[model samples]
Target: MHTTALVLFSGGQDSTTCLAQALSKYERVETLGFDYGQRHHIEMDTRRVVLANLRERFPQWAPHMGEDHVLTLAALQQLGGSSLTDEVAFAMQADGLPNTFVPGRNLLFLTLAGALAYRRGLQVIVTGVCETDFSGYPDCRDDTMKAMQIALSLGLERRLLIETPLMWIDKADTWALAHSLGGQALVDLIIEDTHTCYLGDRVHRNAWGYGCGTCPACELRQRGWARYSARDANASSSP
Candidate 1:
């Protein structure tokens, strides 16, 4: 009997790392993606590619089993507020949550994922939410996740574990862990392949991927990349 796990996959750096980690741990790993009508449709495409590659690598893992994780794209488009789904321009908030916060997004996604996991008899669900590098999203915090876990258990009548492997890890540490786990190839694939910009820009200039590097997301990404590259270079140069 395989231990199945559901991954709340976003096809981004953290989520992709979580996917790889889940692959290493669970006998059967399933993914759940949302078409939350994000401004960047590129993410959805990236998710498809990630899934395809996973299937190519792990032929025994059923590729993408279960129902299509695609939710109602129109409803999300209709619901505004978050920059990801709405026409609102992204603004970098120096403090507090930003416009990118999709209200109740993770809650809804996890609730659906919980249902899926329960249906598949899987007790574990994995997500890539991080508190360290997270952009002040309330749902990314540990407390929020704990509360959601309780709510899910009570409301859904299912005992499921929402595993957040990168909840406390910063981006630099995430890169280090990926390098340590023979996931350098995967990391490179994601860095070069997936899109993470709140503005949907995807070109690395001055060691920045996605976004204009001037934005908060880009600033953090640039810092993380610099740290990782410098450490990796120093390690290589050392005798």
Candidate 2:
């Protein structure tokens, strides 16, 4: 039986890395991207381009790269308090939780992914939610993922494995993981093509993906790239 996995891809650095890792491990890999009425809806465009690039560059994995699914949850915008779904400006620190923290976003995404996985007879679902170096999103934690896994399994009446490859790893480690999975090609794809910017400004390209350079997501990515580059430089200088 061929091992099949579904990836909850967002076309950002972390999810893109998770997708690459899935292609490396799974016999058949399908990706699901959400259109939750986010301000940075260009992420879907990036996802398409990334998938196309992967299929072209890594033809060996092309057979396993199953069809990609894009689901729209536009109602989340109607039910919005989050800066991501609302017209509110993105703010890093506002009160206890960040304004960008879309309530139940990850939960809904994972649940939907699980439903799709169960329907397709897939037992493994990969997500890129990271606890380490994460913003104040509560759903990105390991406990939440575990609980969601159990809920999905019980609800679907099928044992489901939720794979969080970037769960404990920080952004710098995420970069290293991408490099390990697909070498410089993957790394370059992430840097040059993937969209991680919350503001969706493709004009301000950097070592990291195109970002506005001020949002929390961009800050974390920039910091991670700086750390990763420094480490690489030091290693190159070493014996």
Give the winner by lDDT.
Answer: 2
* Candidate 2: tens digits of C-alpha lDDT, residues 198-224: 888899878776989998789999999
Q: Write one digit per residue (lDDT tens) for candidate 1, span 1-239.
A: 34778888877777777877777777777778888677777788877877676556545444434333665546656778677777767775556778787778888888888877777777788998888987888888899888888888888787778889999888888777766644566666666655566666655444534566665566777788888889889989999
The clash count for each model shown is 0, 0
User: If scored against the real structure, what TM-score would every candidate get?
Assistant: 0.86, 0.96
Question: Best by TM-score, which number?
Answer: 2
TM-score of 1: 0.86
**CA-RMSD of model 1:** 2.9
Positional deviation of 51 in candidate 2, in angstroms?
A: 0.1
Global lDDT scores for all candidate models? 0.73, 0.89
